[model samples]
Target: MPIKESRMTQSQNVQLLAVKAQQALMAALRSGQLRDGQFLSMSQLVTMLGLPLSAVREAVKHASSLGLLVTMPKRGIQVMEARPETIRDCLDFRMVLDQEGARRRIANDDLTGLGALRDRHQAFREAALRGETGNTPDGPIEVDLSLHDFLAAGLGNAQLAAAYAANRMRTAIIQNARPFLQDRIISAMEEHLAIMDALERHDADAATGAIRLHYTQTLRWWGVT
Candidate 1:
């Protein structure tokens, strides 16, 4: 039993390493340590992050899947250009989904169950004030995908939620491919809080408007507008 437990723990540790590797890579991309048209070598990554080669490979695979990184035979992993159309499409998709999500949540009177959401936003704000990157768990590449995930899934419409999640993942990668300015981040945080407040009040129009504002501000930040 002890041996089995030890193996399980080792497996967990490997998974954790992979997660950390992805987070580290995201932070690097966000900080411009990696950029579009830049080439990445696995050996270099392993040395840089002090992680096992296999774990770095796991991270590379994920970034490739997101279309943020690609392998060219001679060039290894090269960062892909995040095209303007790509960013615009992502923003457009999110605006539609989030607007609809707000409508459904408000119509269904979901405020009672939003306590957890409220707590999460509050915690994140407090963490920000404390000079901690409270969102490190998901990495900077993705700005709170779970928050949008919650909105998408909140209405209990499985199909809508699935589509939103798919787009959200892609959108997040593009957003995180470049560095975000502090002012833009603060504006987004406020927009999110406003959306949450509107949702809690069951004000569909207000919530929808806030959602649009959030996406518009985000797109503007990404130079989509």
Candidate 2:
């Protein structure tokens, strides 16, 4: 069956299409379908995403602005190599924003969103414990990103939320570098559970502590700290 278009404005349609294309490209890149050093032309992206050329162009521009892709004059767009310095900078920025978000969440006495985050964390933990690989390699990465996104949304800061969304590719790239292990995954889940507990208790001190510890461990995984 053919899909029918909704009654959305042209701009709204473009934005929605761009978002879909961006997500599709990110998924491909994370799964190794679009490998590092592989250059993709606009035509290729259009075909891959089944999107309009304009939508693909806009998505490419957005990704490039986010530092996920680099364009060469004649060579087209290639995935940027995951560099340590870039990863460190991204982690530092994310940590600062996330810590602020946690602090605010605690101060505001918000625990509603924390439950969902905890649930996802527990699911990932159980999957890791059973030595079961997720349906996709990006599964754990998506969970980790969701935790931060939930916090950012709870914080109610538009700017921080935008920044966090912009860094999605960088987060994926960093997570992709780490080896998936049961023990490591379990530890990460425990860390997330601790943070969620703190949030649930509205304990700013404990939440901040957990965030610091989690980031430290994550950096270690990337050989950064």
Candidate 3:
């Protein structure tokens, strides 16, 4: 699941620090060790993670970049809430970003890398079809985000890919907030399959329609459409 962030090819030391720090922070948050409104400084994080200041600095920097930890001058680093507004804005951005991605993939006839991702995508779809079982922490929702990340990465644009990866947890937060929404889960599975089918057929028109359907379905899941 290292493909969860930082392109598989050029994984950096800081990226590894980021992953560990983020995981630790998440574990702390879920366990109520990190409260909703609490703030911590770099030194505290160093102590919390039992690491040196340099390591904690990079780790904290990475978490801040992903909006997980917000650094305020007087308050230090605050655990940022994944608010509904955050999900809405992230989803809004994704609809634009990922739809353009789909367009580019179709325009360039770049279905090559995507084929390699099909097996994982199918696993993601099945995870969606079944909410809790056969899975990781967030189950199907986590797989769905990974699938989206894969599709975004296949666009061959590093900056866009990074942005998509950063916004992914927002999507997961939204879905995890309602993990048992069976109808939305099934709709997501269907839209994912439709998009995959269109990509396999190399049908630009169908792909476009399917991508639109996917985003529109996303809005419906958000209760916005």
On TM-score, the leading prediction is: 2
The better-scoring model by lDDT among 1 and 2 is: 2
Q: Write the per-residue lDDT of candidate 3 for residues 95-203, one digit (tens) a residue.
A: 6676677667777777775665667656655655665444234455654565466568667878887787667644554555445365565667677777778777877
lDDT of every model, 2 decimals: 0.71, 0.76, 0.65
Per-candidate RMSD, Å = 6.2, 4.8, 8.3
lDDT by residue (tens digit), candidate 2, 22-89: 87877776666666556788688788878888877777887788888887776678876767787788
Looking at model 1, the pairs that clash are: none
RMSD of 2: 4.8
Which 10-residue window in model 2 sums to the lowest lDDT?
A: 1-10
Better of 2 and 3 by lDDT: 2
Kindly provide the TM-score of model 2 when superposed on the true structure, using C-alpha atoms: 0.80
Runs of candidate 3 exceeding 4 Å displacement: 1-48, 73-76, 113-137, 169-180
Shift of residue 82 alpha carbon in model 1, Å: 1.7
The Cα error of candidate 3 at residue 91, in Å, is 1.3
Q: Rank the candidates by lDDT, best first.
A: 2, 1, 3
